[model samples]
Target: MKSYDTIIIGAGMSGLAAGIRLAMFDKKVLILEKHTIAGGLNSFYARKGRKLDVGLHAMTNFAKKGERGKPLTKLLKQLRIPYSELALNEQHRSKVVFPNKELSFTNDLNIFTDEIISKFPHEKDGFMALLEDVRNFNEVSLENPYESAKERVSKFIDDECLREMIFCPLLIYGSAWEDDMDFSQFVIMFKSIFMEGFARPEGGVRRVITLLMKKYKELGGEIKFRSGVSEILTEDTKAKGVKLETGEVLLADKVLSSIGYPETVASIKEDLEVKPRVGKLSFTETILCYDKKPAELGIKDTIVFYNENDAYHYRKPKTLFDEKSAVVCLPNNFEIDDYSDGMIRLTFMANFDLWENLSEEEYKNEKNKVLEASKDIVRKLYPSIDMEPNFVDIFTPKTIKKFTSHHGGTVYGSIDKSRDGKTPVNGLYLIGTDQGFLGIVGAMLSGISMANLHCLMPAGAES
Candidate 1:
């Protein structure tokens, strides 16, 4: 049997961050992961000769090296990574295209504001008022107890199209709730994506993951991949240790789980009746590799949020693909290098329950249908490009499940904020998106904060 001060479950971005933090305090920590590699949602896989990025399209909360107190800056500081060494490349512009109205966003908040004023002259005051609320938003409780994003946005903007355009990205990005997403989450996503904008590292998320792993190992943190926890051993309402699938028991003073909270509860030996909040929204991601670059092919824009109609109800579709909206990302547009080829990625929501009942052949058939439909949408969005993709890869919700064990294969963990990384059982804590964080930066922050509150706060003795 192995023992440590704290045992962290899952070696995703959050788990690795928390492990590094704990080990920084000289505490012995062991991170157990089911997969052979780390980076759960923000991971990548190889197909043929291409290195296709799995989940992350872009890193939000972008900040420059000298920028102080920003989330990315703080993350680098906490992890001891030099900001300059990060070498982030800022995005020029990204567009949200509705049927009737379109908005472009940039790294500078003022530019976005200026565009709002230029596009909607009459609603400029209302948009500015909404920005003020977003800037001043400080609800003490982490739980999202206020009205939904749609409800809150409408309070400021009378124009329905503007309101939908403003909140559409937020809903698709952070919201797992169908009808509406909480206002607190809205403010966070708004501040992160719009206020801070997005920037990609020199090599993308793979580099980020490599840096995290290196820092973790340097701090004497141990990570065991391909080792999944079968049960969370407990005694008297407190976590004792974990039993691996290989039947090895690794004891610890405390268990901090980066896995989904509900997944954690279900992992325990005790039959706790905790109702897990399966995320309402999941997605099917299709990657297409082309022999021609976007610049060469007459496509300049990097990311396009396309909504076929004026309605920006960013809810999960009842079918495989939401005909109303889809996000198309051109990877080659952002990179400044002389890379000869390009990659196009299409992402839209999916319903796992619908795919759950399909058989093997039927599953392939359904995914192919979604894939073909996504390509049609992409071609329509860029009618000028005559270049055909040389390679294509499609990942459905089932792929997400196989990798992350998210019950619904949800990209957004859950909408419930009250969980706040705590559980009914003592000596057990939850971190990561299921606790309300939505993106890579937020998830890392969640890990750091949870470590401070749970493990590194001291108060430990193990048997």
Candidate 2:
């Protein structure tokens, strides 16, 4: 049995990033992925010769080449990836659409600030104050304790409508907690979304995965696709190695799991004294490929956070899905429209249990209904575009659970995050969603930070 320096569980963004970091320093690292592909939630699939991105609507925290102190810049710098490789296309604009109000924003913070001032003039001062608070707060601090984002924002913004509108995009995009998010997460989202804003890699999520995989492979990192880990071997309250489902045991001095915290804990044979609460949020997305692009139909927004009601309910739906609110993404609306066909993706919060309990036929019927509802939303958002989609595909929480192995089909993992990536078991760490970071950029950052802090620093010091 060959002993390795580190074994990373899951080939998701965090895992891939951790593997790359470890491998960069010549550490013998192996990444085990249950799926055939990488990217985890932010992955892609091909249907009828067309590639479709899964979780990536837009990559937040867009930065210009060599932009210092930015998340994107930091991530690329840490991973030794050049900014040019991303081929980022900035979003034309995105909106928060409420019942009687609409706020549009672009990559520029001025645009969002102006929109807020114009729409909610009274709350302008409060919004600015909130922005300052968000800017000043070190959201990435590992020692920071959890606080309700809603409560913290309430201190700045008094108008409930404005508050709901501001949080609509942020909450649905990244929050693991229902209704509200942790304050640190809120700040992270706020900076990434409103401050740095949105952009997409030229080839969607595939571009990102390809870049990561290329870098990781160049560093001599080893990864095994469809190599699902059955259990994490522990001895004397420390990680010894991992046992593959096929009964092969690989020994490692350290194990870093990009899988969610609870899932990692469950995989361990030892009954560790910890119960990381699984998050309640999940989603169902409908992808429609139309004959004409959104721009051709006079819809130029890159993404629209659509809410029919004044209050945004960001929680698990009692029904199959909550139709009142949705995230409508127009991939073609970016600066460079690389898609051959116009694509519109609509995401609605859904209940995993409701979808999970359905029989095969019932599941199919429910998915059809969801597809119809998504079309209805498109119609309502843009009445001028009245044409049947050339192709339509819908994915539910069940699909997320099947592909990602995330509990509750959750896009974001457990609400209880391990900020420092430390687990109860020695030599084991958590990265990705449950590591308290948000979005793709955050996930990669989590992996890099954890790998540096827990793995590399000690090795370098010892050497």
Candidate 3:
């Protein structure tokens, strides 16, 4: 049995961040991952010389300055990861196409406002008031407790199209809760994106994960892949160690779980005094096409959103693919030149309950259905590109569950953002998106916060 000061379960972003931070502080650390790679959802795969990112498309929160201050860049600096930014075309930062009309949201806030005004000239007052509401929500989010994005939208904007264009997509993109999530929480999410410009790492998100893993190893942190923890050994209501799938018992002073709360407790198989409420966990499903070049799709460092009138259709249980679709550009210069020849990645949120009980044959059939749906969306958005893709990669909620061990393959660890970021048991910590936020920056911040709290506690003080 191997022993360490800390054992981090799941080597996703949160786990890696925690391992890096703890190791840097001279605490012996070990990160155990069920998959061969370190990145959880952010990892990529190669098929027939084509590389496809599992879930990551374009990332936000990398802006140099924001209302809440510099996020991605600041976090990178603190982690000692060297990074450079890429420019997203202001003309087509995001294009929303509905049945009646299409609108483009630019990177510049003023341009975005002007474009909206031009489209809905008569509703100029409504548009300006909506922007003000967004600004006010950002300013007072940390203090207020509004309970639904829809409520906030109803209060600020009366135009259905404007509300659909903004809040509808925002709800679909951020959480699994169909447009009815807490308003304050939704506002904070929106503020992070508008106030902070979104950018992709020069080499890809995997580069960021790889650098953090390297730094963790440099600090004497150990990692064991394909070693899933089957049980958490406890005594007197405190975690003491873990038993791996291979029956190897490794003891640690503390265990930090980057996986979701339910999965962590399920693995431990113990009754805790406090149990977190389990809401719907959102899964990001994508079908990556390597058939066309970036320019062929009219994509130039920009993302495309195809608006669906029925965003609520996702609430009903469905397969890995849904009606709502978004396409992201992946340029050849960003990653490996060999496989990056001509790649465009398409992603959408999937309902976890839809694929929770599929057989092998059923799963493949459902996957094909998803691929077909993605093709339909692609044809509508990029008319120039061919419908058939040279290569396609499909990731369902089941695939996510197998790799990350998150309940229902939830990308985020928890849904309740109001609770203090803590588990019920002592010496146990929960980080990552499951708690309600998403993105690489948010995951890293959670890990950093947990690690900081742990470091402040004296050695052997809790265990």
Candidate 2, run of 10 with poorest lDDT: 454-463
Rank by TM-score (best first): 2, 1, 3
- RMSD of candidate 2 to the true fold? 1.5
In candidate 3, stretches whose alpha carbon ends up further than 4 angstroms from where it belongs are 65-68, 85-92, 121-146, 277-291, 297-301, 310-320, 324-339, 417-419, 457-463
Model 3, 1-463: lDDT tens per residue? 7788889888888788878888888888899888888888778766675555676655665454332345565566556665543222122365556767666654456756777789878778876776677666543223455466776667767777766666544555566454466775566556555445345554566667767878899988899998888988887777788999999999998888876777777776677865654546555465555555665556654556565663334352454555564544443423233344566566566777778777889888888887777777766666776656766777777788777766766654445552234566667666666544457767777677667666546766523
lDDT (Cα atoms) of all candidates against the true structure = 0.81, 0.92, 0.65
lDDT of 1: 0.81
Any idea how many clashes model 2 has? Answer: 0
Residue-level lDDT of model 1, residues 237-339, one tens digit each, is 7899999999999999889887786678788877676767667788888887777777776777777888888787666687866756888887776645323
Clashes within 3 Å, all models in order:
0, 0, 7
Query: TM-scores of all models?
Result: 0.95, 0.98, 0.85
Candidate 2 segments whose C-alpha is farther than 4 A from its true place: 459-463
Q: What would the TM-score be for candidate 3 when compared with the true structure?
A: 0.85
Number of colliding residue pairs in model 3? 7
The candidate with the higher TM-score, 1 or 3, is: 1
Query: What C-alpha lDDT, on a 0 to 100 scale, does residue 109 get in candidate 2?
Result: 95
RMSD of each: 2.5, 1.5, 3.9
